[model samples]
Target: MIITTAGRSPSKLVMKAKKLSTSYGLSYKERGGVSIESLKEQYQDDIVVVGKERLYIAPLYDESNLFFHPNLAMIRAKRMFKGDEDPLISTAKLTEGMSFLDCTLGLASDSIITSIAVGSSGSVMGVEGNPLLYLLAKEGLSSFSSGNHLFDQAMRRIEVFHSDHLSLLQQTKSDSFDVVYFDPMFHSTIDSSSGMNSIRGQAVKSELTKEVIKEAMRVARERVVLKDHWKSDRFAQFGFTQHKRKTSLFHYGTIELN
Candidate 1:
């Protein structure tokens, strides 16, 4: 069954969402269109489709929660690094004093994870183009830090902005970051029918493109890591040399930049 709340207000959108949930015989709650209980209920044993213009599915039982599903970053990271550590936690070899510019913040999971990895001395600057995702990410971060020490510390170490990747990168000086991380969404070959649907992922994939990589490279100080699919030629066409490659259970790819 398909339910659409396209071009609806927040309150009305929630109403439509609720109607769909009830029709599906699933328990649900509405809190400004960010429903945790409802998601947990619907995704418990099945997949759920959400949003209108940019659609996404959520798997109720995924280990990383619906937001930070392994299918998102983990696969991309593994494909980029070849067989390295956890992509969310270990995509880049972060140092305590280094500053990073995440060209594509997406859901801000990588930024939050990177902030923790970098510790107190390091800083992470993240840019997200989509207003909705940026707002959602900001809200999530704010909520995550409510009276939490780790959240407070992580929030302090990270700076998020709502802007296009290229525009933001143009504003930064050359060599600003020790590492500029680019995870621009390449067209995925994985069937959405079997994987968790991420709202932010779908929006990001639809909006991000290869030109963002060129901008990322221009501003990176030491290196630029472009995440791509194993079969994608975006890296090669862009003249990037492969620095690392990794494979995983679901996907494969390389990490390369000059």
Candidate 2:
């Protein structure tokens, strides 16, 4: 894949793009008044455009640009501050000083919320298999500001990695985190949000296996959680106790270790 700056790019943004290309070992292409479409056709590869606000990945086929956005995390955070409980927090039994491992870090919306629930005393790490998606989430989590100090801090606090979840889980020590969580790609489209659609094409699509659950169980001190469609059989297949939420398209399942 090649990295380039947005149209009419400033020198600073160009420098940033070049730096990212070196850091990630991607080719740096001078914009030269070429459109993303032309760039894709010429290079026959995915293009990462470093914009002023976010890094957009323009696929060779898909018209939608995949970039990082807080998505629903910002809303959930506001509700949490208003004394409303977040479903994931409730399902994970998260507290202020807990640590969370997010195996599937799509755009990191859940990770941001998990970070908030864990607070400064807590730890949150997320892993994404897609390199471009990882870069997008990593950059956004580090620099994206919501103008709310607490929310911004939550986004920034997350530790992100570009690796397969199972590999990371295998490397983790037993009881390493309080909660180990997985939110794999849904079997069916639950929400067709533009952001989700953008990620769906590039995000890793892997089924959770018994080995993964075993590794997660071994690594988690408190519990192992799975977030999937309400109708998914994974809860039963993975020995997770389904925590069904009425009127919700998805539900959380947990295997409490303690």
lDDT of 2 at 175: 91
lDDT for model 1 comes to 0.54
Q: Tell me the whole-model lDDT of each prediction, alpha carbons only.
A: 0.54, 0.87
lDDT of 1 by residue, 1-258 (tens): 223232333665567566756744444443335454354565454333345333333444443323222234333443433635555344456656777787777666567656756778888888877544554455445444335465456755678788888788878887778778766652243224233233434344434456666666667766666565555566577655544445532222233343
- Model 2, poorest ten-residue lDDT window? 186-195
Q: Which structure among the candidates has the greatest TM-score?
A: 2
Worst 10 residues of 1 by lDDT: 62-71
| Candidate 1 Cα deviation (angstroms), residue 29 | 18
Error of 2 at 175 (Å): 0.7
Give candidate 2 regions above 4 Å deviation: 186-199
Q: Tens digits of per-residue lDDT for model 2 on 48-160?
A: 99988778888767787766667578878899999999999999999999999999887788899999999999999999998877888898899887899999998888999
